[model samples]
Target: MPVYEFRCQACQRKSSFFVRSIGGSLSPACTACGSREMSRVISGFAYHKSMATIHEESGGPDRPGSDYYKDPRNIGRWTEKKFKDLGMEMPSQIQEMIQSAREGEMPESVKDLQPNLTDV
Candidate 1:
């Protein structure tokens, strides 16, 4: 089985079709506009990751002493890994604070976390 994507020349709309056999010819008709003049399109595909793999690579969010800011040396690498794992933006304030902490100047925002730091 193979999935093929097509784009309508008239309406510029894109549609996808899943064919059972590779030998079969695809009817590149635009579903939206019913246009016969369509072109096969390059489309992106989905990728999946298991939870175990994600946790292994991301250091699972619940793990203790695994805070990115715990060690000064982990400043840049940890922050990047955390943000990449969570698939979100690191707030500018937090980013600035991390940079400051990396430079030996702890920011006031994270001062309360000082006592929680442990030797990893």
Candidate 2:
């Protein structure tokens, strides 16, 4: 099986179509808006990472260090891992909050953690 990606001209959203063989034909429609006008785009490739590679880039979640939290991807990883360990899906709201924090939004509750600037 092969997957081909196309960008819908109408909505500018991407959609993928799967072909059973390399010679198969496809007339994929926009998944979002059902538009027939589509443009083929280069899709990102994926590869499998070995255990060693994963652990090396994992930033030592179990092992602690001052710099461990420097990477934004590392933030909320503990909560994510916890949810995964419990075999439960994280609520969309919490996921959104974590994503927002990763994108540098300060949560309202953490605003008080900031030092009083006038006192400096």
lDDT of candidate 1 at residue 57, scale 0 to 100: 57
TM-score against truth, every candidate: 0.37, 0.41
lDDT of 1 by residue, 4-119 (tens): 77889999998888867877877878999899888988666311224445546545333534554456755555555667788989888777787787888876765643434454
Each model's lDDT comes to 0.66, 0.68
The runs of at least 3 residues in candidate 2 whose Cα sits more than 4 Å from the true structure, single-residue gaps closed, are: 1-58, 108-120
lDDT of 2 at 29: 93
Task: Flag regions of model 1 displaced more than 4 Å.
Answer: 46-120
**lDDT computed for candidate 2:** 0.68
Tell how far residue 73 is off in model 1, in angstroms: 28
Model 2, residue 55: distance off in Å is 4.7
Candidate 2 residue-wise lDDT, 19-78, digit = tens: 677776788899999999999887753112245555665546455345555566666666
Model 1 scores worst on lDDT over the 10 consecutive residues at 45-54
